[model samples]
Target: MKQVLVLGAHGQIAQIVTKNLLAEDVQQKLFLRSSARLTVANPQKEKLIEGNALSLFDLQQAMEGVDIVYANLAGNVVESAKNVIAAMKAKGVKRLIWISTLGIYDEVPGEYGKWNHEQLDGGYLETYAEAAQLIEDSDLDYTIIRPAWLDNQDEVSYELTRKGEAFKGTEVSRKSIADLVTKIIGEPSLYVRESLGVNKPNTDGNKPAWYR
Candidate 1:
């Protein structure tokens, strides 16, 4: 069974992924900044480790005896990615699945693209892009997921754009992101060393639906 280590396990997307992990026959290690924040019932089934993703010592401890690392980390993400990469290398872990955003690539088209840069350029988009670069340059087998603006919808419907293509649509359900992560965990070879853009099918508009 694949022993999976989840970084930033408390985030919305990671929480959904954590719930799904319980159903799989895999050993899960959840790494969070504080142990008190973990509220999952029957939590004994999974290993819960408290640590900062940016701390090499913390990450190294969390990554021990792991096979795949699912990084749901944010905030100073480029530095976080660097720390993760270093820790993974130290542990000799091979696969990494990282969450990124679509606008980082400037792949959202026309007015939407303009709006994306205007809103996120100096903020999330910049750091996310740098983080992607760090992961892409690393030797570890990796899949960087760039999802459109996220929502709390219940279903898993979604679509994708390969690297270099304009990202389609404006928003995707958080559940959709979780489902994709589950799929990748089940089949580690799928999309190795690739960065993918995900969105809901036919949802493309001048901007996100909520913006209208």
Candidate 2:
């Protein structure tokens, strides 16, 4: 059984992933800034640890004996990515699934691309891009997931586009990303060392449906 460590465990998708993994055979260590935010329902399959991603020491301590790291983080992400990489190296753990936003690579084309920039440029997109580049430059097996505009729908329906391809659709359910993460955790060999763009099928528009 692989020992998985989840950083940013308080995130919506991470919480969903935790619920999904509970049914599986893997063990999970959920690391959050305030561990009190989450409860561990299964003592055998799950452990909740308090740690900040910006602290390399905290990360190294949390990463001990872990095989896979799923980082679903936001804010000061570049520093966090650096700390995660360094800590993972210290603990000799590979295999990372990094959650990043779409438009980081300017991969969304046409009017939606322009609109995305209007929504994310100046700071968010640039920082996420830098963080992803740092991850790419690292030697560890990493799969960076760039999710299109996310909704809280209960459905799991998504498509994937690889790096260098124009991104598809305008939005995807957060549950879809969770499903993909769970799938990757089940078979760690899938999509290794690649960046994936995730979105729902045939939802293309100048903006997401809700936004329109």
Candidate 3:
């Protein structure tokens, strides 16, 4: 079984990814600052390692013997990403699946894009942008998954786009992002070193309806 380490295991997307990985019968080690609020009813199937995403020492410990690293950490993205990269370097781990947000590239346009900018003011989005750049510059084989506005409703289904193209939609479900992560884990070669945007297809409006 492949040993996978997931950072930010308490978040919505992370939670869904955890469940999907378990369903795949993969051995998962979750690293979080606090696991008390995480109600994973099945303890026997998954391993929980309590640790902060900012702590390199904690991350190093959690990454031991892990084959893949899935990072879903939020806030101070650059710092946290640096820590993850450092840990991966020390452990000689090569593959990483990073969860980033859309608009990091200013690819989402118009009114919805304006709203996104407002929501991510004070350079929060820039932080993620810098983190993505770091991943691009790193030697590790990395797949950056940038998803559209996140929603909690329904199942996994969405469209994906490569860099330079606009991510033409809105509100992908957390479950859908989780499904993408699971798929990436199983097929690591599919998106290596690629930064892709994921969104639900928009069939209305002159432009992508979902973006507006």
Off by over 4 Å in 3: 203-212
lDDT of 3 by residue, 29-86 (tens): 8888887767764676688889988888999999999989999998778989999999
| Model 1 vs truth, CA RMSD | 1.1
What do the candidate models score in CA lDDT, each in turn? 0.90, 0.96, 0.84
The local lDDT score (0 to 100) that residue 52 gets in candidate 2 is 92
Candidate 2, overall lDDT? 0.96
Best by lDDT: 2
lDDT string, candidate 2, 7-92, tens digits: 99999999999999999999999999998899998999999999899999999999988999999999999999999999999999
* Per-candidate count of clashing residue pairs (backbone under 3 Å): 0, 0, 0
Candidate order (TM-score): 2, 1, 3
Which 10-residue span in candidate 3 carries the lowest summed lDDT? 203-212
Whole-model lDDT, candidate 3? Answer: 0.84
Query: Which residue window of length 10 is worst by lDDT in model 2?
Result: 203-212
Listing every candidate in turn, what is its Cα RMSD in Å to the true structure after a full C-alpha superposition? 1.1, 0.7, 2.4
Please state the error at residue 129 of candidate 2 in Å: 0.2
